[model samples]
Target: MSEVRVILHTDKRQALLREAQAEIRENQGRIPAGDFYARKLSAAWRRARGTRAYGPGEDQDDIGEFSLERFRDLPVTPRESLKAQPLRYAAVTPTEASEYYETTGTTGQPTPTPRLAEDTIWNTVSVAEAWRPLLGADERVVILLPSDVVPVADLVSGVCEYLDLAHIRAYPFATGITGWDRLEAMWRTFRPTTVFVAPGVALQFTRLLAQRGQLDELSSSVDRLACSGGGYTYTAAAGPGPSAARVGLARRTQGRPALPGGEASPGGRHCLHRPHRRTRAGRPG
Candidate 1:
């Protein structure tokens, strides 16, 4: 098994590192060992370290002698820096590349992130490992998200493929209310044990389905509901209320609780606010 550990100032980083380490140890000897993402990050860290030197002779000294204090003094690389040197920034060559992903660029320009082939494989493996406990061997899964292939959807699809589960489906809903009827049709036909959705579309679908008394149609087959694409607020901007409320509705209808640590917006009605009990009560079982 390959093991990769990341250390950051935050506890969240530490916890993630531990989880990754545990995953590595769990699969040790079965795969190449080491953090692929960390390797890329470490390369960036080295570049940051090298740029911090002040004295004339500092350039000639071995990296081992490079002071940690100087490294700490290095200016952080901005998104533009990564964008400026995408090729140099990569830890591994394309030969080891399995997939390419991009930031949605909602804030600014999108940045393309490349994944090493092994990292992609391990990612699917990790997901399968986590999901195996929750999902049964015979359970069916349907992925309903954007048409454009995103990393999260790709990961979910790849994991389903790896598991060789009996039924796995993908229906592209894109953004907004563009494909509600099509999505509804697929929902009826697939009757999946799992359903994944983009945040905005998930919310819209939840509202529409609830209004039409069709929410239970989805809940009947889908026990697990997964969503991604920013927080509920960002998602809500694309349509109605926060994505979390939509997620909560999906979970409640399906008889499950929402996943923790999802993004939130204070005083945001559509993204983070819980649905009104009256609204939920009026919905059909």
Candidate 2:
């Protein structure tokens, strides 16, 4: 069962969504790739000096105009920097940051990654644009991902709010609150039309349904199942692909729809799975 449930009142969420939409509108729906990275890297460079190799230096003032050559010249921060000294990477102060989160440390040590209102709005709207076609106001979404210190749940919540779609968080791994049994009970009443889950968890849930002989009855209402996680290992030659699992869950569950992937620290996260047409051959994309 789920432990946390923080609902942003409808009015507040709408206001925030509008701000995100305006940002996209002003940029003409797409920001130049080079200019986006140039601004981000430049801001990161202006942070407080430290013993880190990429700290401020004499050449800090004159970062030339945005160009392919100039962008390449900018210092590239190593992935290990987050694990070594997380605070040094923060471009905003504690007061400025609206929310605080940390990674699962699956790949390495968990790192602190705080976010601002701007971060939430931008990420929400960007993903909503790509997912809007697949979602509708009449549909109800069930998000089966971890919410504590993880940005994926929050990102999905933001997208739902932005699109004015109904949604609920029912992470089955949340022991007492959203355990498999409890979630099964909730499904009877909620009757979600869409489900967003991780690949591993989705498989586990499917097995649970089949064991209980309720796979068809419980999954009948669900038409869409979107999975996102660290990495997908399913292969058509050996391991089970998404199509095989989808078939077990429900007859109506549609083809794979792309959703943005989240990191332990989900700052500036973007789409991971690309939308693909459903194939008769059932190949994993």
Candidate 3:
């Protein structure tokens, strides 16, 4: 018989585990009840509690009173645990699971998350409902995020499909049109009324188009500019810092004001600039 020994680098390992556990707790409440991912999480919690037992040398009298509450109080759903026992935690049967998305764990392990068909539709419908006010029924939306291969991309595409909008274009950040000319061509060809882009990409586009003197052309056709993923600050390119003039230029050219502190009209067409704070993640633009 051979025996294997395991050693723990106490300080580093404990710190990493603490951080991962905190993240799991923060994300737990936000998980949608109907989601297969959430159901899997519930199952994982149950299994972890069920298998935990007191050591043999432990007091016999305390055995019955010893509750799983102590173990449950400690975070048990770290990404590592999910990765180690994926099948045990999965809510959907193998035959029923259609989509699998993986998140990189703290230790660089891939944690697989299952998704059902109805979960896809529900997510799509939710996104469409949230953005419908900003995007009119006749408008076309250009998705300037990553390609629709990942979960985020799939959700965006699904939302657009559910909306029944005529045009939905996706430009991959990696290989799609980079220059102003190419971008302008795509924008014109697609004739998108609504442009959905991340704040970082939008800022880069603003800088590039401004330099090329093509900012107006891009902004002219876009009725609504939806800033997805994150927010930005509208500051001047030169002179007395982020002056009202420069900020206005950036906002007008970008077709949407900088998020967080900016205000939008009730109808959702026009944006009003004000002293505002940055918008939080998962918040509507």
Question: Which candidate wins on lDDT?
Answer: 2
- TM-score of decoy 1: 0.57
Q: Per-residue lDDT of 176-261 in model 1, one digit per residue for the tens?
A: 64367877787687677665565655666677876676665455555555655433322111122233235443222122213322
Better-scoring candidate (TM-score), 1 or 3 = 1
* RMSD after Cα superposition, model 3: 16.0
Q: Which model, 2 or 3, shows the larger TM-score?
A: 2
Per-residue lDDT of candidate 2, residues 79-161 (tens digit): 78667887766766566677777765224577777676656666667677667766777989888764444677777777787
Count of steric clashes across candidates, in order: 8, 5, 2
Worst 10 residues of 2 by lDDT: 231-240
Clashes by residue pair, model 2? 1-177, 1-178, 1-179, 2-177, 2-178
TM-score, prediction 2? 0.68
Whole-model lDDT per candidate: 0.49, 0.58, 0.46
Tell me each candidate's TM-score.
0.57, 0.68, 0.50
Runs of candidate 1 with Cα error greater than 4 angstroms are 1-75, 92-96, 105-107, 167-171, 174-178, 230-285
Compared to the true structure, candidate 3 yields what TM-score? 0.50
Residue-level lDDT of model 3, residues 166-281, one tens digit each, is 65555545564454456667876877766665445555665666666655555556665555431333332211112211222234425443322121111112221222221223
Q: Who wins the TM-score comparison?
A: 2
